[model samples]
Target chain A: MAQIEIRDLGIDYRKPKSNEVFSAVDSVDLSVEKGEFVTIVGSSGCGKSTLLMAVAGLVDLTRGSIEIDGKRVDGPGPDRAVVFQEASLLPWRSVRGNVKFGLEMQRWSGGDLNERAMQMIRLVGLGRFSDYHPHQLSGGMRQRVNIARALAVDPEVLLMDEPFGALDAQTREIMGTELLRIWERAKKTALFVTHDIDEAIFLADKIVVMGRNPGHIKEVIKVDLPRPRNESILDSDAFHELRKRLRAHLAEDMSSMQLVQEVA
Target chain B: MIAEFFYRRQALVLGTLSMIGIVVFWQIAVDTGFINPFFISTPSQVAAEFKVQFEDGSVATNVAATLYCFVWSLGLAALVGTILGMLAGWFADVESALEPFIWFKYSAPTVAFYPLFVAGLGYGTPTIIAIAFLFALTPIYANTLSGIKNTDRDLARAARSFGARPLDIFLRVALPGSVPVMMAGLRLGVGRALTGVVVAELFGANAGLGYAITYYGQLMQTTKMMVSIVIVIALGVLLTQILSFLETRTDSWRVDSGR
Candidate 1:
């Protein structure tokens, strides 16, 4: 059995001002293996983030179920940690403190909490910034702290929802590279959600493409890239081929999105 | 040499110089007969009266009485406001139930109810404390409510994803996040509660700085009255300064966001 199995999962959200209930995710089925790095790519409102949130047990399912280690997921647990789109560090805490928040919450008795947090901070190359507050760091640095905080919990699975979405292109690429390096070292199952195609192909073992209008997976493309991938892969033929295929899928999604917009 | 010292501590030097200048100017004006000392007493006269009051122990007694009421009022306001505000912020029903009453107390002239308090509790420390408590309660409640309500949703969400229970979220996330705002509320409460204590003393109290002010004013002893006024002003400044110092210390982690 897969490490994390999501079967026919569905989620619905009620309109804030209205009583209307609408589906956000529907009939979604996906499974992640142990230590696999999977990326989900889609346009905004495609429910890709919603799917990730469900797997993280942050959202309630309207239908179907999600299971981890053959146990049905109910609510957020210490078994998985989520890296939010925003590096949601507590403004009142230093980098080390933010990193230790999850461990403190879990009542983790694995070792000294401060030592574990410091180790994760150093792993993310933020050893010099252990005492810095969230606001003192740059956007890239803040996201690195967020990643470190998630990893500090020593979770079996890591969920990232566009962890670098708020960053510039150059910074985003750098973070992506950095993330893969961290993932390699941590060796934990990771589900990263992003809209950047190159990012999807570069870091992912398999890319799950999602479509909106009651969001569902359209396809899952297995990335054939070798290990220890670097920036040079962006200039390679195989990378271009995969990028082209992903682009085609997105183009199709965009046109369909425009049609839905016109209909609305 | 002096310029270097002044530049190193400009604010401190300037503030001290300005205060000394004002007192010297006032004394000079009174001595030169440019201003009437009978209506607004000279700085020296006020200082003399202060020394006399200090020696007689009336200053100490009155100050202690005023401070006693002020402390009780502010302490009760902080405790009750924080508890109620937390409930109001966390539960929609509690907030809606409190909304109208809180707004009413906020906008209404709270001092006008002093007569009612006097009738219920009788004139003295109880009445004085009640008035001051009313004055201080609203700001503390409002600020704590806003602080808890405005706690960053992202932070709470992050905490939740880490398996933090509701109590954990409240204690670790919401309480700490709300500290800066709650401290601001306390600062405002400090001023308002002081005002309330003095106002109550001015009307019905037998002791306190406010009573001293009224007594000296009626006797046409401007220097003595000015002594009490100066003490009140000094108390206000000192309390606010202490709170501002605490605010900065507690909020040390907050820096201007680069993003």
Candidate 2:
């Protein structure tokens, strides 16, 4: 059985400037098996984050429903945890404190809370910096804490909206590799959103290409490359071929709106 | 030492120079009888009188009465105003419902209403405390309501996502988030209450620093009157500094995102 099933999900929000109804996310349907890692890749303002918010139940659904393991997504619950792009950590808390905060909310008690939090801190390669506050952490280290905080809850569905989006290219690549290593051990269902096609290809079993200007899905290409993926995989024929196909698809999609071609 | 001196030197030097100059001028004036020693008491005369008052235990009763009024007004107003403000901030309808009463209490000349206080509560410690409470409440109410209202909704939503119930959101997120703002209110409140106590005591009370000023001034003991005024001002400054120090220490966990 599918661990999460999202059917014809739609989200509408107020445009901040004026009195106009707009769709941030339009009719979309997707499903994730219990352990499959899916990545949604899109341009900026493509409503990929909004889609993640819908899955997390932070935003209201205008149409359709999402079921997490046969239970409908009502208001936000502990079962689904989200990692925001900006590492929305509680600044007052230390690394361990932030990680343990979820467990605290879940009514965890005794040394188990500390033990569980420490383990996750170690998992994120932040064990040495356990006592450091979020303000003391670098962008990469903070994102690591963000990921660890999400995983600490032992959530079934991990929703990440470009968690490493703001890091430098080098740091982002390192984090991508680190994420795969952690995901393999945890084996949690993930729905990650990123603008980087390479990041999507490297992290996801299924790369969902999204197009903005009404926010619609462009393609959903399944990456056939097997697990424990490495940098050498980027040079492989299959990886190059898949990247070529997606690029062609994006280029063709952009051809109709060729005014952007000059800039691209 | 040089860098530190340069960093603070101008203000420090000016302050020290002013202090030295005032003392020098005061000593010379008293020696030359330039200013009447009885009316404009030099700092030395006041200090000597303070020592006399201290030895005789006269300062204690006045100090105690002033402190009692301070504690009464501060404690009662803070508790009532803060709770009411929290409630009003939490629920919009409550804010609107109580707006008139809160506004009236805030804007109406509390000092002019001194007669009403004396009429109802009588000219005693309670009346003085009541006046202080009235002056102190407006800031506490306004700041508290704003503090709770201004708590980041994003954090509240984030807490809610983590299975935080309404109580948890209020206690952990809203209340802690409101601490800095609430502390600002408390600082303003203490200052206002001190002023109120002085006013009420002057008009209604037979003892306390305000009474000391009045009792001495009526007998043309200007030096004693100035001494009482100085004591009240010093008390205000001391209390403000202590509360502000506590605020900085306790709310250090918070980020002032300027939100």
CAPRI docking class of candidate 1:
medium
Off by over 4 Å in 1: A258-264, B1-35, B257-259
Candidate 1 structure quality by residue, lDDT tens digits, B26-52: 999999999999999999889988999
lDDT (tens digit, per residue) of candidate 1 on A188-216: 99999999998999999999999988999
Give the lowest summed-lDDT range of ten residues in model 1 chain B.
B250-259
Give the lDDT of residue A163 in candidate 2: 89
Q: Which residue pairs show collisions in model 1?
A: none
Which residue pairs in candidate 2 collide?
none
lDDT tens digits by residue: candidate 2, A1-264: 798888988788888889788988787888788899999987776788888888888889988899999999977877888887654777777899888877777676546888999999999999899998887789999899989988998899899988888999999989999999999999999999988878888888998888766677888888889889877787889888888877776675566455665478
